[model samples]
Target: MNPVPDLVPARMVSEFVYCKRSFYLEWVLGQFQENHEVAEGTALHRKVNAVKGSVPATSEEKPFKATSVQLSSPELGLVAKLDVLEGDGSFSIPIEFKRGAPQLGDDPVWLKDKVQVLIQALLLREAGHKCSTAYVWYDKVKRRVSVPITKEAIDWALAQVADLKKVAASHKIPKPLIDSPKCRRCSLVEMCIPDETNALDGKSAQPPRRMVATDPASRALYITTQGTYIGLSNGVVELREDRVTQEKVRLLDVSEINLYGRIEVSSTLIGACLERNIPILWFSSGGWFKGYASGAMSGNVDLRRRQVLASITGALDYAKTMIAGKIANCRTLLRRNAKIDVEPTLTELTRALARVKRCKDKQSLLGVEGIAAKAYFSAFDAMLKAEMGFTLEGRNKRPPTDPVNAMLSFLYAALAKEMTVSLLSVGFDPYQGLLHEPRFNRAALALDMMEEFRPLVVDSTVVKLVNTGVATPDKFQYRGDGCIMKPGMKKDLLRAYERRLDETIIHPVFKYRTEYRRALRLQCRLLAGVMMEDIAKYVAFTTR
Candidate 1:
């Protein structure tokens, strides 16, 4: 059965014909940028599309030429605005204007341009106009190329649109083309990163996809209010403010939904989420972990048993590696952000890294990790400007008595929730521990996994917020021997956290740039692979 797209813009069909990944990147990922070629193309499009009124007949002009003919067909769910529609009402033809020269092959014209005009022709046919043939006018060579609107070409274009609909259904970005020349001219080169990722394509045994979600490109919806209710309506997740609908998101576009405070969710929404396997995380009004709920687990039982066994008996090596990564990342953060001379702190962290390699058990690993953390936090106060008044005396959790501690603790707790979900998605039992002690309700494994990212994601974000005066002392309320964020501060911090997660960095192992959220998921998957002995050694994320 062919999947029909909800709406197919005729231009996107041309993009689909040109490069599938470009279409996915542009439409699905909502990513685009303007390069030289794109700017030039835009200028050309403006010039061609700006021809107002009828074309005056010259020696070189066609008998009947009209500029910018708009047409749509509800039956085919297609829409197009041809650059020029020629001939008469009885026998009209759509002519597309191309910025470049006509690309002629065994076929009459370029398939991308051909399919585009064919769509315009189809739309014209549905709108009660005769459209048997179409023409493409090339500006560069001043040539007119004819494209036959044959059944074979129309069927092929329809099939392509159906495939595009299937891609939309998945909500995952399609892989880049192998050895594509179009990549060189693509405006999204930096975003797509085809140069580095494409290197893996030639290999017979390629690495696994480096994201944890069922669909990596899907967006997460966060609800912070207490009285907000979520329900399912017409294949979309509806957010209501006390029974009045506020926002709606299609079910397929949501990867995860996080509910904070006393947000109410109906059973129908839960069932919809379960059917789609999107995890829902619950947090306190103050951004503390409350609980987690999700659909059925998808990891292998045997692999999980092996992971549990490793955590219980043989996790010291993994702990040492992860701790080393954490300490090294902490040093890097200090080196990058510290205003004063960071040499002393970096030297101490270097010694801690050396001590990590020699650690034979979890206790020694903790000792080294502790020393590195102490040095890192002692220098943390110097990283910020004095005007910001955000200072870290030490790493404190429970009450987070200071402003810096309050923000850091909240960020860490949020990070733990993300790591917990990521670990669970990759089939790891969050309660099992490698470094942190296992408790009945504690997500010890998630804590262990988040150690490396604490400095990378949380500390870096805190530094940026504090340095930029984005998080002020007034935002933190001191009461009852503890400091907590106000409502405004909480919103600002959530925004900061989400932005940080979207930031991309080159992966230490994969050597390809990926979002921090995807990196977190990738790390969990890599750990799972290590436990399953699919990979010889576990490599934790580290930064320069």
Candidate 2:
């Protein structure tokens, strides 16, 4: 099926510059993992995100508290929680906190990071913050560098977003560009296969799957040849069926046949095509297409199984309430001091629930969260660093440079993967999700379900791991384009992750306790029940 256009996310500039396969695996397959450099970077960022202080009167003077924080842009479709947003008593400067010492002003990623800052600058303007230039705070040098968000730079980001959308719309997977050194880190290198397959040894000839058609333009003939008629489309086709004269085409001598698009195949046509064994691409729309692909129906009928559960209202309400309850549970898991961190977000989460529940369709509900999550995430990022005793400072995009985004993208993948397994067990197809776009190989529905549980599972575990030292310096590595999980670290992380899910939580509605993993499965079954008119219990989950 052709993916509906515009459903895909408008990716940031970073994804295009990085390895396409990584983009495919991440943005497409939604698989994510973490390594060593990333873990340390997260720790370092906590300080910068919370750093108090402003800007110098001149280039030499010291600075104080940042005024404007977390600037975003709609046109560029980029949102960043900037480190030093307010500047020198007046000007609106977008300050980026960097860990690597300092480099000649020409480094590519530095330049790229700058473009993002520039986009934020324009966004700040759109959001009503007056600004001229942006700055990068280099932790190593302990100073900020000036950058110009010139017309040229802003112009570049605009062009890039357009290009990104174009590429996203074309769902084809092209061959790997082995020429780029970046390919070394691609997750699908094992599956995509760089080397060409061996040719069949002509010494042992194999039969072709198809026979050429006879008609010059129509190409309607199959493999059969009734007579050795010379100039039979200038090719020889073996004959199997009897030569016959058809009323429509007059007398024609032919044998077995395999026509192309020239004819539509039906029971009559299939009988002929099967006698001839011709392959064709079957077409359908909507659930019919789904049922066809599943091979559960023979005619035009589609089998959309109804859930056996009868209390749909209860199940639906349960799904939403469980989600909100999970969010509340996460708040309890945070270190005591972080309780201060919970109140505002708890408010927003509640607000999002109202917004989420009020949603008339899945797409609108998704867009609401997409925007809400972007804004809401900045707060959580702050809470995570403070409670875990670390910081997450950096840009949020493909191959994240900031600590928070890196953690977020990785956690999103891990949590969603677990939910995919959960949904499948409950017989709710993950592909037919509400919030996320149905991209090739992407489990959109699974992503939608994962949103509510993110804080309870991934976010909480990440903080606990960092705070308790269960996940430490040696567990991460940063040699690649950016900090990523060490080679063997995923197994360890997943173990910790699974353990966290297995940790029991009191069920508010069930009047009992259950593992988070099982809870996820029950949620899916409840959603299915809702669609099948089996239950009425459904509520949008929020704070935990």
What are the Cα lDDT values of the candidates?
0.77, 0.48
* Model 1 steric clash pairs: none
Clashes of each: 0, 51
lDDT of 2 by residue, 339-407 (tens): 354566656655765665665554455565555554455455545534444565533645655444555
TM-scores, all models, native as reference: 0.62, 0.39
Off by over 4 Å in 2: 1-346, 357-364, 381-389, 394-397, 402-404, 479-481, 540-544
**What does candidate 1's lDDT look like per residue over 1-544, in tens digits?**
2234566889888998888877865665444556766766778777557655563322134457667666677778787888887766346778887778766566657878988988987876676666788898877888888888888978888888777788765634566665566776677654454433444344323442332212345777888877999999889899999789999889879978888798999999899888767888888776787768887765245446877888879688889888988998998888888888889989999999999999888887888888888888989987898887777887877788898888888888789899988877666788888899988768999999999999999998889999999999888898898898887887787789989999978777666568898788767856765664434477778989
Model 1: how far is 212 from its true place, Å?
A: 10
Scored by TM-score, the top model is 1
